[model samples]
Target: MTPPPPSTGQPGPATRRTVLRALAALPASALALGAAPGLLTTATAAAPARGYATRYTVVPFLDSSDAGVSVYQSDDATDFRLIKAAAYTPPANRVRDASVLKHTDGRYYLTYTTHTWQDTSTTIGFARSTDLVNWTFLYDYTVPIMNLSRAWAPEWFVDGDGSVNVLVSCSTTADEWTFTPYRLKAADSALTSWSAPVALSGIGANHIDTFVVRAGSTYHAFTKNETTKYIEYATAAALTGPYTFRGTGDWAGWGGTREGPALVQLDNGAWRIFFDGYGDGSYYYSDSYDTFATWSAPAKLPAVSGTVRHFTVLKETVTGGPTLPTGVTRSFRSANYTTRYWQEQSALVNLPVVGSASTTAEKQAATFTIVAGLADSGGCSFRNAAGNYLRHYDFRARFDAHDGTSTFAADATFVLRAGASSGSVRLESYNYPGRYLRHYDYQLRVDAADGTDLFRQDSSFAAVTAWA
Candidate 1:
């Protein structure tokens, strides 16, 4: 839907009806992502451990005079602590709609609109950082369009082939303008060279504040319909796209007001969409289980220390060993032999086998914390409560607390496969992909699958909380 008259600064009733009608006419299957229609609900699941300390860093626009990029970080998305109040100052001294992207090369790039509000300018500010704290302003570019009066809300996405593309809202008219999303490609890692602007299609007319995120194999673009002041989305298979329009959803239940949409995937695998409630001077968010078809009622995030607007959230990876989840320690109980538990014997972590236990002390030996193994390759190593790791020696499962050698790490790592039931997971040794961790006749060994029902049952184990 095209935006309402530009100079009015408000949409009339007819414009609102047009937007509502457009939203209602969207295909139900497209809107629900193939799920049954229902009110927005939140999904509850165990927060997936990052296998390391992962940080969520936010970059928000402060204000006009001091409208520098502000940095805030949180381990969990629920609690944000300010890191740097003014991480970088724009060359124009006025900035809004700040977006940050961490490139594959380990450098960070920040882009924003150099002008605030209706005062149009062709300049879009740019900066880069090796460390998120200190940013060096690389130089701003004026869109090549001759009549370009505004360049606002510049956001960026990195392609699979390592190319960086910047998307920005631009308008040619100074007063009565229709803002549209356009793209620019950076030629190098430093973002010093850029290609000319190319208009994005399939997002409808007069859209702004574009943000794109990948869910599974599809790329979803979320943007504000500047005319209707409602948030809508489209999906594309590739980074540069002939994007297909999805459906529109109201932000925080507010119609014709919410703008500058941003998104973040939480540790619990829930997707959150954040929008600026400019009328209330607060940022509101909604959670979605699927890719953004339906949404939970918009709720305000914990208030930041200062006035913030039009921001971006980025997940930062910290270098270190795996940081095990606080309460993920579990015991593996054999499915075939219900009373038997996997245990590691001796302080050296040798002789790992399934054994019957009658007392609490005996059962404690079976408890283990699954940790990321061997260079944090997403495979896991079980660390017994005795501080020893379950590793394979000579193709036989054993315990080895002191095997700091690469061989031990490689042998110890196992890729976990989800079983048919809840709280059930199967372990496949990294060294032997076709083989699994199974106990044959109560002896722990890594054996090849025989394609028998009994073999599958023997390979599976129920992960239960350790005995009290």
Candidate 2:
């Protein structure tokens, strides 16, 4: 279908048509991953279709200057309704950013961070709301955050260890000065008693929007680089220490700014991040104030699967040759003798000799080799443009999944053929070293979404010796 004009100018809620289109496309085959049995809605045998609204009026709060710690009931862009605003008054330390979460007890926790004056404190605060709107402040930690940039990006995740932690980025200095990344743990949801703000090592010194998510037993923290104009990020295995920096190359320039990354690992082996960039705001849009005047895409919040009737999709592909069976002898992407690594890719590929190839087929096989390394590869993930689904391959990228465990950061990588025949091809780490192959299969899935061209293999083989 001729995709509707890219979402522009419209705000508040998504139009009804948009909603229907997106809803219709939710793949019923997707098996819910990580989430409990009923966390996601199952595709009905047959169901209704609706249009996406033009304006999702569900604004957590009514504010043009960016309200903080809010929730708005919305489906797409057109029809939106805000049920409540932040119970805490917005004084000199106006709102910064927020996240709305639901726990096992049925209590909704609104964990968000505030930007203070003396320093950008990574403060954690919350309120309870039965209906996303109308919040009641249960905790206020905005004050006394002078040590760890005061906690700027305060996102909450239930670690795999079964403990809840507030994943926040820090800027050691004040917001007016400089900043860095840090993590503060909560004994439970009790904001009053925190495990103390601990500085995450490995990150050079300055990073913005520090958030972490859980994947199995490890943790993946997402961060931004203030040192360079181009986008950059870092990853770490644990929550509070030793993060490795992957420079500009991995900075996912997909969106102009590439900062403030929020991630969710959906079922079907997809890891998606909701980030802010140019088109959505003035700071990043090429036409707005301080405009870069380049083809840079704007930094705007991506409309989640819940907000769109339909989503825009951009596809990529790698060919036999740059000119197809002609130009560029850059070696078959999977033809491996040395070692290879990629994040996201398109369609698929034909396996040529890669590792220890003696014959045509041997040298052509795209065998994936995986090693149990630190999950700190600043890799990338593929997107389904239409759905809120993503496939994250980077091990070290910090994720704030609200899931507790030591297994969220980085796992292992599996090497085999292309498609997961019988849909068995998948990777995920949940802690325990017992299931190495399945735990890190996605590690070998390099290159972002490209047109199909890969070998389908079984779990027994890490190095593809044959093709299907």
Tens digit per residue, CA lDDT, model 2, 181-209: 54556665444567765666775444555
On TM-score, the leading prediction is 1
TM-score of model number 2: 0.44
- Alpha-carbon shift of residue 441 in model 1 (angstroms): 50
Model 2 poorest ten-residue lDDT run: 31-40
Model 1 lDDT tens row, 1-468: 111111103432221123334445554321210000000112222232334444677777653333577788754453456789788886655656677888767888888777654355678888889888998887878878768777766777665555778877667664324566777888876777889878777764466667777665677787776555677778887655678877765533545566677777754345777777654656766666555666666656654622565677776545532233333787777766777767665532222344444466666767778777652355577876667777776556877675577656767776554433455556666544335788776767777554445666777788777752
Instruction: Give candidate 1 regions above 4 Å deviation.
Output: 1-51, 63-66, 174-176, 249-256, 320-468
Q: Which stretches of candidate 2 lie over 4 Å from their true place?
A: 1-63, 66-70, 73-93, 115-123, 142-149, 172-176, 189-191, 229-233, 246-251, 278-468
Models 1 onward score TM values of 0.59, 0.44
lDDT of 2: 0.34
